[model samples]
Target: MCIENKYPHAETTRIENTLGQRPKMFEIDMLVPNGDAFEIKWRDATTDGDHITKEHTRLKVIANAGYHPIRVMFYYPQREQARRIQKTLETLYAGVGGHYYFGDSAWQYVRDYTEVDLLAVLNRIASEKTHGE
Candidate 1:
């Protein structure tokens, strides 16, 4: 995958020694740049609902830590599921900075990594404040 330096190095955080937790660790996918933090969730139709919950908790914790939490949810796989997840994400991110990309198809979200240059859409998103339409 083409690693773009546009985003800062991601730090995955988890609650330590929390055994027997159904969700295990809440991996906080983040890019910290200029002292601000952005949270990313690359999800497909098959993505577990639990993952979304965990990510939201992680975002809340990040915000509690005094960092700007930007939640970016990339939903692909199916239009109907994408729309569902997009709406859910919108509600979760109300008043927060974030965006959701409902890809036309799964390939659209992975084209670049698959030698199809599909990342243009994601690149534009990474540069913009939000993703819609």
Candidate 2:
């Protein structure tokens, strides 16, 4: 809803999943026409190897659809396996000419792209809630 409000033209596009026996559609987080296809995650601590393959395929699909794939993960995992998976994902993103941002960089990217100080706004809301409570 924030994306729709901020970027009136931004859309959440669906891609059909042909790999599974049952047909399904994968939702791309947010896409701006002639711009970036964003895959956003609050945190991804997936240690599953399949996750990597799935992400790789998703990136390819975005690229094939004529959009630059960009990943924004606000939190980086602490576990060793999860960190390794994150690293692999970072490499995959770079391999396909996509950009990956994590931690502070992720927040900065959102602020830069949306021209809004999202973190500050969130902090203000949090402060208000704490004080009101």
lDDT tens per residue, model 1, 3-115: 23333354554443243355555454544544345444466453567756755665555555555654444544457765665567656655444433344443443343235
What digit string (tens of lDDT, one per residue) describes model 2 on residues 61-118? 6777677989999889889999999999999999889999999999998888887777
- The regions of model 2 sitting more than 4 angstroms off are 1-6, 17-24
Give the worst 10-residue stretch by lDDT in candidate 2.
17-26
lDDT of 1: 0.50
- What is residue 78's positional error in candidate 1, in angstroms? 1.0
* Candidate 1 wrongly placed segments (more than 4 Å): 1-4, 7-25, 46-52, 73-75, 79-82, 97-133
The best candidate in terms of TM-score = 2
lDDT of each: 0.50, 0.83
Error of 2 at 38 (Å): 0.6
